[model samples]
Target: MLALASFISKHHPTLPITLISTADAASTPPSVTYRRLPDLAPPQPPIKNPVESFFETHRLHKPNLRAALVEISEKSRIAALVLDIFCNAAFHVSAALGIPTDFYVSNGSPGAAVFLNFPTMDETLDVDIGDMNDYLHFPGFPAIHSTPSKTVVFLCFGRRGLHSAEQLKETAVALERSGHRFLWSVRNPPGKGGDVPNLEEILPEGFLERTKEKGFVVRSWAPQSEVLSHEAVAGFVTHCGRSSVMEAVSSGVAMIAWPIDAKQKMNKVFLVEEMKAALPLDTGEGGLVTADELERRVRELMDATTGRAIRHRVAEMKASAAAAVGENGSSVLALHKFINDCCGRADG
Candidate 1:
């Protein structure tokens, strides 16, 4: 959204723009005004699932969001409201006020494709998600600590997707069994949130010391971009978040695509099936990935023949991604055309 907003501002210096969100903006460009929505303090945890809870909480702000839209619309005409794909509720609000709307899909093309194909999926896969007795798994889909240069595997599940303590211990077991160097970033388990956990209290007894020579674990957060771009970094074990995927592609690292929830399953399909730059890990009963499968996937990423093929494909993609942002690239041209269209409509 920032990229599009920034480009729009640059193209039409006189255009007035305001960005509204539930969260405070950081480092917003001077050309754009950032307005934060009223705070709805996060739901106290031990919630069923973090992702669902997050969306539900945001949905509660619809009344306030409508007010914000009205307040802003009263001040100046909104040319077009470019909304995040998940925030579809705002479409009705904008339409009621006679404002044009467009969706901002940060997930890029593959994600866009999935969004377009939802009807097909619904028709083909007949399962009532709301009526399910057992957990409905949307399938692909951890943390790491350091910069180990092409030698260690990096694991991170996005902010709200952290696994349970029991699962983390299983993950530790998998890393130990895999016999590869690793960096694991520890966080409070999903739905089990309170405070950052003590490593000793959760991990398998002797797990840290046993892998001390080859592993590094840090609490809560790690410098993802810095670590992923490091020359020593090998492969990423990720939740297939769009941001993470883009970062990995730019760094030319193939991935172990593990889709946690929501739209990530589609991302895993795009990365593993279409892009062929990632490998998928299968989950077992209760959605827990066994140590054996985790170990195998890690090895698959490190296997010379298969690993080299994925790396070569990702490198080619990296080059193409670079070219797309270069002079006269498709993305640049598309953005220019979009701005012109929006401005043209605004003028009319």
Candidate 2:
């Protein structure tokens, strides 16, 4: 979101952009108008036990968001409203105000975007998402085939403590056993006291020293876009978050799908089955992925011939992604149309 907003602010300074998020004043960028919203779905309190907390928070935001929209519209000549796909409640507000609303999926994958529009597409095609062997087809893209060694980047889990301590420990053990060079972004568990936990206490003893030469574990936060853009990084072990998936694709990196929550599982399906841009890890049994299995999968992705093919396909998609956002690109043309349609001019 920041990247897109920054680009617009830099290229079209006259156009105003307002960002409605739970981010605080310090975190919000100066390029955009930031409306402070209560973070009902905070990272603390471990939002795992009762999944309703997440939904309830979104429901709670409806009234406040509606008021904010109405207030903003009254202050300015609103052209159009762009919203995250999950912000369905806000759609009603836009409709009530007779304003046009555009849903931003934020993944930037044409294949994934098309998959989301499947309902509007021909309903005759029977694409079995459960079958990895089945070829899922989309318009404007070549047939996606399974490939075999792409360098792997592993993200332990999402921000909301979806994984248990045992699962995290198992992930650490797998990374060690894989013997592959990696960058792991590790975060403190939800509900933990103020201080960040020591790496020794969290990971296996001697784990850091053993992998010091090849692996880097970043506690709290890591510059994900920078890390993924590195030439050495070829694939991602991710939770299938939209932004992360788009970043991986834009950087020509393949994936090992390990979706943890929400629409992530659906995104994983798009990457693994629809787009064939990823390999899926099985966590259905016991919910604990053994070190041996992790090592095998890592080796297959990093050292196998099939991994090379996957990397090649991902490179092609990277070119497509770049072209889509380039001058006179599909996304560029769409933006122009949207501006002209909403504001009655392309200058806005």
lDDT of 1: 0.79
| lDDT comparing candidate 2 with the true structure | 0.71
Query: What are the candidates' C-alpha RMSDs?
Result: 25.3, 24.9
Best by TM-score: 1
| Residue runs of model 1 more than 4 Å from their true location after superposition | 1-148, 191-193
Scored against the true structure, residue 271 in model 2 reaches a CA lDDT of 90
lDDT values for all models: 0.79, 0.71
Give the best candidate by lDDT.
1
lDDT of 1 by residue, 1-348 (tens): 777788888888778888888876855667789888887656445559878877766677777788888888788887788999888777777788888999988898656755665666456433344213211223221111112246779998778667877778888999999999898878877665565778887889998999999999888888888888887677899999999999999888879987899799999999998999899999888888888888899988966444767877787888888988899988899999999999999999
TM-score of every candidate: 0.56, 0.54
